[model samples]
Target: MRIRTRGYERRRRELELLIVADIVTIFAWVLGFYGLHPNGHIDFLNPWLTIVVLVPLGAHVANRHLAADADAILLPLATLLNGLGYVMIGVLDPTQAHLQALWTLISVFAYVVCIFFVRNPDSLDRYRYLLAILGIGLLFSPMLPGIGENIGGERLWVHLGSLSFQPVEVSKLLLAIFLTSLLVEKRDLLARLRGGGLRRFGPIALTFGLALAIMAVEKDVGFALLIFVTFVLVMWIGTGNRIYLLFGAVTFVLGLVVGGAVLPQVHQRISVWLDPWKHAATTGYQLIQAQYAFGIGGLSGTGLGLSHPTVPVATSDFIFAAFGQELGLLGTSAIIISFLLLIGAGLRVALRAHGEFSSLLAMTMTIILALQTFFILAGVIRVLPLTGMTLPFLAYGGSSLLTNYILLAILMRISHRSNQFNDLREGTTG
Candidate 1:
């Protein structure tokens, strides 16, 4: 009885914290909007705009009431980050804000659906191959004749009449599920196989390698790298083998070298990363402009809307550079901190997961989010070649927002199950 009472108290506190955090997130959204457009007034009662802020808060309330055992901090942190992204998009381009709001609604809907339906994370194992095929199909669908569309030299988007989206965004989640299921089932076989580690996991490695190859062929290098890194990390965790990590790192570097030599786009990006000014007129233009944004935004910022740095795609790929220009170092750091909190909460869930499948699923999901964030952040700062990846949760894209929310929902569900398992164990011991 005492143990049950403690568990109930803990869940109650978690729910309370989630509610407060979501309220604070909404406040931040409003504050950011008003700060950006001080003289410009907004109709607070506007249904379209009001739903933008209220949808996430409403989702939080529903999640707490429905999935009270879910990770307390994950939803609120994601809400804050999503809200921050919406504000940045609104400031950068008012036209797209409504579209982003619509996407937010869709993403929240997906989140709710996942929480309600995917109660047993382990059930995903049954459809691993099916999910893998769907993921691969989606990744390559952008190459099809009618529906495929190329934007900014990357053939990543697909169009269906009026609607357009990056199919790989959905593919990432499906691939994560497929990989998690595969690893959990094959972990022991991988560890205790007769042949050496490489041979044993060769089929699995080749399968993912083929997917990465497809992504590379499509010129979606960022997603390819993300898939590669996530695959290698999960393999390392699942097999407890250091060789896979070492081999993967070496192979990645070698692939980059070969790719840079053979692929003009890859070569150009590498050259620009080496020195943005030399090619500033052509390939290096965006990076150079981004550098300028960071330079002008040294400490606090130029103040929102006061100085508009002309960064190409400021609402999407280079959104961080825009944030740096307006929000400055302090504001950007706060954004980073929010992401850190989110990633940390995800890792907590992974660690607390009761079953192998749930644990691997949670960890892989977190890795996917973390890797995407790192790739984009590093690219923006010129620490790595610019890969044209959207910043997770904080980038203006319906596909990305929806995919990430689904990832969060899965994490929450796994956390909820883990908490229940822990409670059961405690009750039994008591």
Candidate 2:
């Protein structure tokens, strides 16, 4: 009875912290929105703004009531990051904030669905092949006639009537599930250094290679690179094999070189990345503006909407730059720290998971989020060639936002189950 009481008290405290974090996030968004538009007073009656502020809190309450053992930090961290994204979007483009609010509601709904259905991550293994096929099909759907749309030189968007979204966003999560399931099942076989030859790893290699090839053809170098890096990480971690990692790195570099030589768009991006000033008037214009935004914002930010740095796609690809301009280096660092904390929580869940499949799933999802975040961050700062990937929670994209929420939901579910298992084991031993 005492142990149960302590457990209840701890959960109650966690719920309190989660609620406070959600409230703080809502306040930050409201304050930032008004700060950006000083002339426009806060409209407490604005239905969308009210929904934006309430949904996260409501989600937390629902999760606590439904999944009392869900990771307390995960949802709150995501909520704060997402709220910051909303504020940045509100500052850069008010229209996008409106759309983002709608997407947030939709994402919350998705999160609830995930929490309710995905009780056991291991059960997903049975449908790995089906999920893989569906994932690949979604990735390919953007190429279909009349439904396909190209934006920012990347043919990655699929339009159906009035609705348009990036199929790869959904595909990324599906593929993560498929890869986690497959890797767990064949860990030993794939990790073996001898025997079986090409037949053993050929199918896995072909699947990933075909996906990368399609992404390259679609001019989504960012997504291709992301997929490549994630596949390598998952393979390496799942199998504990360094040879596969080295081979993947070598193959990836070769692919980049060959693709750069063959594709004009790839060639252009590489050239711009190598010397942005040389092509400032043409391909490097955005990078130049981004650099200027960073320079203008030194240690502290320009303080929301004070400096209007005109970088193309500031709300999406170069959002970090826009954020750096408004919130400064310190603010940007805080955002990065939030992501690091989220990753840390995910790794903890992976480490604590009871089953191999659940462990691999949590680890793979964490790697995907971390890699995607690093890719976009490195690209924006010129640490690597810009591949135009959306920054996880901070970038302004409906599909990306929704996909991340689903990922968070799964992580929370896994964490809850792991905790339950640990508690049961303790009780048995006690």
Candidate 3:
């Protein structure tokens, strides 16, 4: 009964937070409209404008019926971030805002589908190898002739007639699932480096080779780094071995050296990172503009739509710069805090998961988010080379948004399953 009571409280708290988020989101939209059209009237009744509120409200209702005991904080936290992204994108480029809203609606449908159908998290483990193959194929699909696109110097998108999308966005989620299941099954073998020797080491070398191939062939340093870092971290966690950490560092350096020498893209990125001003008018223009945006943002932003971010790709890759220039330091700090909270909540779910596969899967998903966030933010500030990766839910990309929502749905399922197990145990004891 106590467990049931706590679950009810969690549901209530989630509803309350969602309400607060909706209210704030509408206010932000109003502010954006005023800034964009100083004298124009703001209309909150428009269906396009109200999608944010409706979507979350509908999801909350679905969760009550489908996953009542899931983590309360994840949905509200993600909603807040996504709402902020909507307002920022609307302000940055009103033309793109409607498309973003449409994508959000579609993503919510996908999220609901996953929550409704994926009742058993462990079932995914059964098809691990097949999923891994499909994921690898998707990851390299952008390299295919005719269909593959070379946009803005990166071969990361596929064009199908009039439709275009990045395959890596979907590939990442599948790869994470595969890695989780594989590590869980091989934990004992991987943990024993002494006897396993070359056999166990073979998997490590293959993973490293995959990362190198991505960097060398795909020429996407950001994603290659993301994949390698996630693999190393998840492996260490799965085996509880510090040796993996040492191996990871050495392999990372070797990859960098080989990449920098052989790949012009890698070398050029490093050059631009070291000194953007030298190529301010050409190669380093975006990074230079981003730095200026931060300077202009100071402590408190220029007040949303009031400040124009001239940085290229301000709506997607460098959206954080848009936030900094318009909302200032206070706004960016709030976003960072929210991500930290998300990481904490995800780790909590992993810790309390009912089985090893679920636990490892949860951890793998959390690491991907954490690393992706860090890489983009760090790159924006020039702490690392700028990578063309979107800022998760905050970036305006339909494929990315859809993939992230599916990830969220999976996490909710894991959380719900864990809670169900706890409730069963409580009943048995009583």
Candidate 4:
């Protein structure tokens, strides 16, 4: 639906007030960094950073999802992103990696916030159409300007000057929406796919088979695994189908074997996972460093700015390592607990939503959040082979931060509406 003004003006005003609070937090952070580098100019104060702050606010004014149901959590999320960006900018400057994070922070933030701000969150029904466009786009995103295949053997990123955006980020959002739309539409039928009969066989099996085929061609086991897991979970959640769950497990194993055999890269990831120390000089360095950080951190961290983040790209793909190194295991555990809270909160919103589509949106988004957290954390802890995906809010990627922010915004909106719906039924709002 097109963005429009509803009764969200009050909510928007409230968000503005929250932004002020965020700016205050940022100011204190920047000042501390400046004090740390008194002789060195703190360039965190840049035109680019301003763009990050302003454009998303502008786009949100255009897109309109913000006001439908403002929640307190959204404020904190924005603050987290900006704060991390400040840290990345200050830390990486001495290292001399470009401020890609800052740029992405600006453009995508504007794009996503506008999407939620202009429209009533209650009106955001779903992004089926947008998701479709993104799906088609991802099919050829590797062909976009400045997009060259990365070292992981996937052409997932599209670069622009010093900044690179993961076009697949858009695809992830689209794919989740598409899956949620299907599950919600077919809930009753798929819900019946338990131990019923051959007629109840999982059609998702065939769809996943196709994904495995395509991803195999690209040799991207990680993407394949993520999409496959998403489908199975959404199906299970919607229908309560235990058989579908079992089938997914079996198929996942089959796919893993096939992937390992057909894709040398997949073999390498698993090999590295099995013994990262063997490949410590090559592919295993990140995980090795990650383990070291956690092992040394013990409970309370070494304290922020105190630990050595020897892992490459500590702010992005391995931000958790940064957390582990600086904040220690206790800090890392807090972050993990926060995600668990987000998952619980998102599921509660799904359960309470008034409509199936809205429920699907919440459930699908929650799955996205859970899987994203699982993906990177699993990689860091060596539960799964290393993949090049980023940690969600804490990671220093613009596209990821933007996508997650929008997801959180949508969830908060749904929760607020669901609560309001219950209140009306209970005659509280009136």
Which candidate leads the pack in lDDT? 3
Error of 2 at 83 (Å): 0.5
Q: Give RMSD (Å) of candidate 3 vs. truth.
A: 1.8
Clashing pairs in 2: none
TM-score of 3: 0.96
Evaluate residue 147 in candidate 1 and report its C-alpha lDDT on the 0 to 100 scale.
98
**Residue-by-residue lDDT tens digits, candidate 3, 1-430:** 3434556766888899998888878888888888889999777796776897779878888788888889899888888888989999998887788888988899999999999988989999998989999999999999999999988878899999977888898898898898888888888989986787766656567778988888777878888889888989999988988888898899889988988999998889999999999999999999999999998999998887887789899999999998999888998999999889988888999999999999999999999888999999999989999878888888899888898889898999999889878877887321
Shift of residue 401 alpha carbon in model 4, Å: 1.9
Clashes of each: 0, 0, 1, 20
lDDT of 4 by residue, 1-430 (tens): 6443333553565457548745753564465455455566656566545554554455344324444443444444444444544554455343322354454555455546544562444344366667666675774576655564565677666776766667666677677777677677667767773444554454576557756754765555656677778878778877886877898888888877887898787889899999998999988887898888787777886654445467777767777876676667776776777677667767878888877777878888888878877988898888988767777766666677667766766776666666667756776422
1 against 3, candidate with superior lDDT: 3
Which residue segments of model 3 deviate by more than 4 Å? 1-4, 427-430
Best by TM-score: 3
The RMSD of every model to the true structure, in order and in angstroms, is: 2.5, 2.1, 1.8, 5.1
RMSD of 1: 2.5
Q: Report lDDT (Cα) of residue 300, candidate 4.
A: 83
